[model samples]
Target: MTVHEVHFPVRFEASVEDQPGPLWKARFDRYWPAYRTWFLRTATVGRPTYLDCRRAMRQHMPELVPVWESLVDLAGGGDVEARFLSLWCPPPYIGGCTQAVWLDPTGHEEPALLRNYDYAPALLEGNWVATRWLGPRVVAMSDCLWGALDGINEAGLACSLSFGGRAVSGQGFGVPLVLRYVLEMATTTREAVRMLERLPVSTTYSITMLDRQADWATVFVAPDRKAEVVRQAVVTNHQRDIEWPEHAKATRSVERQSWLAARVAQPGSAQDIAMALMSPPMVQDAYQRGYGTLYTASYRPRSGAIGLLWPGSEPWMQSVADFKEGQRDIVFPPPPAAVGST
Candidate 1:
């Protein structure tokens, strides 16, 4: 295991802006080639599903239209809407993550979120970014795909997502986009739950949200557009109960869930919990294979602060009071081998 100290700079933009400017353009351009390859291979084949998701976005959250349009203009024009829609309806991809919310826990000074995002090792290199969308003033960490994986808003609403442990794909939006929508629009756990319920998702996902009021909910969403809310404090990849047999057999969802439940049952401070996530049962170590724990993020909604840590620097903390102040790059450990090399 190795670690590198890098800064994560956040960019702010308003919806009224015609374009995302040159920096954003460069980032988008760098990601476009790979994105286009993925889009053509997966989403383009499901045209109707893509259009349906597009319609759903238009109907359910029209306010986001301007942002999509801005992305299109930034792309220098070419069916960017379709490409954006493709992100909302991505091809099936397997991911592992563990997330939990601590509400009013003893010795826990404030409400906090503990999360570890495990994915392809290559992604840890450059695709991940943190941004503060000025239009709605949301501070979030996202990928080259332009959808938020986790974030908090100025209103003290924070949320994160975990794979729902189901492989079924349907006609709906991606979880990341839905997360972005919630952070951008909702101010409370109830409002975030409502958005999760109303939105049509193309895959299975569990979204855990926390607010400054100490309210939290883990909403389990399916490909069929069915959503059920579980008011539990911990969540892994699967729902409370697994419905997909193959998915259940394949993922460590149940094991991770049990591990989290037991850890939270004992009294611990926020730091203790966050540190626990950096170890076994939480921190996965298959970096060369692309299923390793890339980063762990702790969001403190009450104080509007974020702390980030990776494999080697668990005891040390990198605190960001405001994500909009300056630019920083979070230097990452070199990939174990060339990505996908056998």
Candidate 2:
């Protein structure tokens, strides 16, 4: 038996709000049905208890508790809604992404964080969001309804997450919420690294942080080990070694990492580095496998600007400093079968 080939159209939206309100409500209403179905996929495994979820929030990320309550309120405040929003040891998820820090030797381009989010398009939240949920403004792509996939904060810190290419799962929060927490709480790469060192992720993930000070670090966090922080720039699906060979092969993680590493070692502008992500070896077009390059996100942490690019489409630009609200209908024309995947 085999799976049928399929592809999807993604609707990328830029939404702004000071707090949870109409935009959040409409989004919840539009996607909660699908989200509910996905959330209950682990019914047989027994999802975490609501009390346990709240306790985890209180114990680890207490600052986000109020925001959780607000999101739950907007979600109708059911037991499942509360638990799912906590992102505390919920259902397992894995995604493909390529991220790197751009430091130009020519002194022409400001430091930037370049990312390509490769995933099943239908599952992509598609919300390029800007919010003031926790005081400082955050501009990011939304995941888990409210959590960030990759984003920059008003404090000039930018963060992105990629699956650590391991199957291990344990008691900890999802990486999406942790990314959100970092954007809200940290002001620099050093501060973000320290925070990730102590935060427990439910599974393995590689988190890359960049700041306006031209500082950068990549933290490899997992459920089964202590966090490892390195000053390396490029990150893909794995950590120091390839732990999952099948996933490594499927995502072409090693090849993509090597390609980007070689690319980063050269002299070029930040835009040149970001544009590389759209080409072969960096772009993954295996939509049939549930992971394909959906969008390229270039974050200029020095100025808090986001450039959302497609292969042939005009880049949709936004910023944490002054976010514009609009929507873009996105079409993911398949890229050529490349030498590697992101």
Candidate 3:
């Protein structure tokens, strides 16, 4: 899909939080700055529940109160509006796997990074901690979707988010914080899935988690406080293995997923199949979407490695980064013993 040109100035810091379990929630509390209102409005469908997520964030991260207050003030009377509203509604049939390829139409350009800094070297004084500057290297959109978007934590657990087609009309789910929370709190995929399943959030979304040993599951949450887990396997953009009114809706993204899945080689790593989904623009839905979409991401739990490919670009941009594509890969490592086990 041709995405709205967005320049994301992001930073990834990997460290244990001050408190043991609050890592995910707290990070959402702390670094809620870079989150753009446009992403929240359009992407999240502008639910008041999202605001509740922000409120929880403020409660947990009192230190960022000033900043949060400023953001709220910027919004004036109510929730901040999103500048960009991109595609959502890829078919639910586009199943996910322990090791699968990822795709991000956005975050594919040269990073117009204003500035970046990390505090991992200085032992974390609190629950928040970050890794060293892993890369000063230039990367493509993988950073938004591959790097910071989803990846494994130092403890070897991997996490990723896929769309969930459910109606969400509340004010309390913070998407970025939720992503960050998984990496921060859970050391294994199972733990991460549990955290998401139990979280009393009102956001309409789903998450896939894999542990160091390849155990994987999906956590789906709705505005009704109804959360369920698809044990052993999961997928998204719609409910997996079940039909929901929202999931059944036909959209171009759904068509593309079906088209890609048919051509993908099965009984192989999902990551490989995902990469296959990024077929050349000639065969892709790029023409359907004037903006064009070609980037995809895949994760190999066995190797604790991630493979990224950009078929739309010249020479086919490919590299391996940590689960989080926020940083560039200097050297791709060997795959791990199991698919999802870090």
* TM-score, every prediction: 0.83, 0.95, 0.50
| Clash count list over all predictions | 7, 0, 58
Residue pair clashes in candidate 1: 6-329, 6-330, 6-331, 7-328, 7-329, 7-330, 9-328
The global Cα lDDT (0 to 1) of model 1 is: 0.68
Which candidate has the highest lDDT of all? 2
lDDT of 2 at 233: 86
Q: At residue 50, give the lDDT of candidate 3.
A: 38
**Model 1 quality (TM-score):** 0.83
- The predictions' CA RMSDs to the true structure, in order, are 5.8, 2.8, 13.1
lDDT comparison, 1 vs 3, better candidate: 1
Off by over 4 Å in 2: 1-7, 44-46, 334-342
The local distance difference test score of model 3 is: 0.37
Q: Which ten residues in a row have the lowest lDDT in candidate 3?
A: 110-119
